[model samples]
Target: MMFHYYAVLAIAALSCSSTRFGVVNAQIVGQFSLEFTAVFKPAGIAQKLFTELSDPETSILQGSILSTSGLIYDPNNVAIKEVAGQFAGGVQPFLNPPDISADGTIDGQCTATSVNEEEGKILAHSCFFNICAIEADDCINFYSGSPFVYAPALDQNQLPPSYPGTIIGGTGVFEGIEGSVEVITVAGREFTSQTSSSGDIAQRIFLNTNFEFLERRKI
Candidate 1:
């Protein structure tokens, strides 16, 4: 009975020590960025017929699978400088010793929400990306919540080159994380025509994604 009483006291002491040291309710505070080139390819396309009074053109929904074997680079790296050069209309030189930091794929789907005479079609997209971190030897899944694409005259070229996107949540090291992503289309092609029922096209974009861990809830 005496030994049992001592053990109970010891456990209580350890608990108090942990509380005093601020071991509980620790906040994760910091941010990191990821950059990679992903190629977008059509995976599926479905047309939605207009049943109500609306535009004469048929609305279509499209799904795409974006894959990448491209090397990831730190924003401060020389390889990124080269990409920036290309963005600025300078010759894009090959990145030697290509810094292989990470690679990933994204699954995305978009549908027309509305059509305008001069502004063309407005699309809403939801995309999720899974990345393999070669340096950390881990993986993170980032969900880009709804981002809008405004295409004027039904031309994807009218879409914004750089747009704001959000990382609502993630997995792995990024579990319970949230932040913003700046999507920059370094190079892209027009999406398949709305009238065409079948075909595929390829395009590339550089995703500059940033993250910060969300405040952890107390147990």
Candidate 2:
């Protein structure tokens, strides 16, 4: 069965000077959106880890990991635009020319901390995305709070629900940046085995007038 997920996340940033938590008043807000396909296919436990529970009723226990890597795209293209139309929210495809990529790569990592079998959801911790520009060496990083709900797919053709995240900081051109981000899982698949899982995802990044960006060095 092929699982799919559709996300329309918004990410925005404000340039800052301090590390972790310092705010500078700059009137300029950097905003943009990028689309990407995410795949979760880990080769082994070293890259992906799962904790098995004795409860046979439990499909997913606490302390499982979600890791994936894929390509980033500029949503302005016709191919992605057509795909966006198939989702629920009649979301328009767009591209922010200055900071992000026309096409690039993305890597994500998140770990489950709590499980809700009754609701079919898991609370994940330290979720983040590292997106890089194609051909360029610069990459921007976005992170989630200590915990966020990881919703499961509704059917055999969809992925878990998308969640909110923050732009902690970045490297090279994206250094000392701050912003708000909404990650849309445009497409994805559940990792159901000891070997691998796969999916496709898209992200829309925009700046928030009320908040400031957090700074952290690239990993």
Candidate 3:
């Protein structure tokens, strides 16, 4: 059988600087919703790491992981807007587990690109994320930077949950551009995982995101 989970999550805003544009100069907010499901499929110790239990039934450990999602999409409209990506990096407190407390965190980098095969234009970016579990059911995440950073400063460029993230740089038309997005609405569920016949038990993460483009302009 297949397992699925849906959670309502709150999203953080992002920022980027530009002499030609300002957040206040934003004249319109374009809203878009994004949803996607991901899985953890690993070999050797990884499969055991994400699927095993610690002494307290739930514990987090210090290790690194690499995971990828299937396909993400924009719903309702007949036309499809999609993207696919993955995350990989280190986790805190290996002796203890993956998601246990507010201190349990994941520091990683991600790469996502829009897949609008029909239009022949694929927009993709490379960025970093810092996610910290707040409680048993909540976690705060920060994402920042882009592919153009020359070097990836995963730790230094992180954007916090309370603040909007800025666009440092990007691919294609987003190059040298600065902008911040507003959270229209965000909601998700408790993190859950399930085992499969293939020995790969992936956690189910269902997220619904609606955000408005607060600022988008060339520098």
Candidate 4:
């Protein structure tokens, strides 16, 4: 028998920043669903099995189940094209923001630029930071010192768990003009198990299904 499963993550942009140091709000919405069908065999065994397995009464007994154990991150945010442009005399400014928001909240900001002229065209500064609350009066801040490849088409699923993947690839200040960029693909998989029984006989099974990241543009 074969089964099909699907998982989706929906993101909604709450607002856009007004300036280079402005903040934005967002949400992380996720869902999971599964469909099961029995593979047919010769001599009507498959038809009989499917008929028996698909019955309202037996469907529950044979159907595969799916659940949301937990989410990787409740909410994450990444800033793209917020601060990018050429400086005076076409001196191309090194584009780097103060921080990147993973929880959809902006805490702090950073400023960065290219080290040289030629490097400015091929590379840009990629800085990111996050805010952590300490009690009600105190809070700790974190930041990324070295810049990374700046690619807006990518998303967190494409980068390391600690940072969003949307920041990977393209010409950036992190690496110099001569620096090289590499493209990579990342995917998520869901784990599932199934159990069935007929009369006194019973069986247990386990399976793995894959989920893909769909790119969405913020309007």
lDDT winner: 2
Q: Report the number of the highest-TM-score candidate.
A: 2
State the weakest 10-residue window (summed lDDT) of model 4.
197-206
Better of 1 and 4 by TM-score: 1
Per-residue lDDT of 1-219 in model 2, one digit per residue for the tens? 000112222553322221111112222233433223332223411244444457554455466676667654434331323332233232223334334333446677777777775675676666777766555555668887555665543343443556677777766556666666666554433345435433333444332322222332322
| Tens-digit lDDT track of model 4 for 56-146 | 4442211111111110111112111212222111111111332422111213222333322233221233333222211121111233344
Quantify all predictions' global Cα lDDT against the true fold.
0.36, 0.46, 0.25, 0.21
Question: What is the C-alpha local distance difference test score of candidate 4?
Answer: 0.21
* Model 3 lDDT per residue over 1-219, tens place: 011112223463333221222111212223322222222223311212222255555322222132332211112111211222111111111111233111222233334333223332223333343222212222224343332221112231221121234433332222233334222112111112322212222121222222232433331
What TM value does model 4 have? 0.20
What does candidate 3 score on TM? 0.24
Better by TM-score, candidate 3 or 2? 2
Supply candidate 2's per-residue lDDT for 181.
65
Candidate 3: list runs displaced more than 4 Å: 1-59, 63-66, 77-164, 181-219
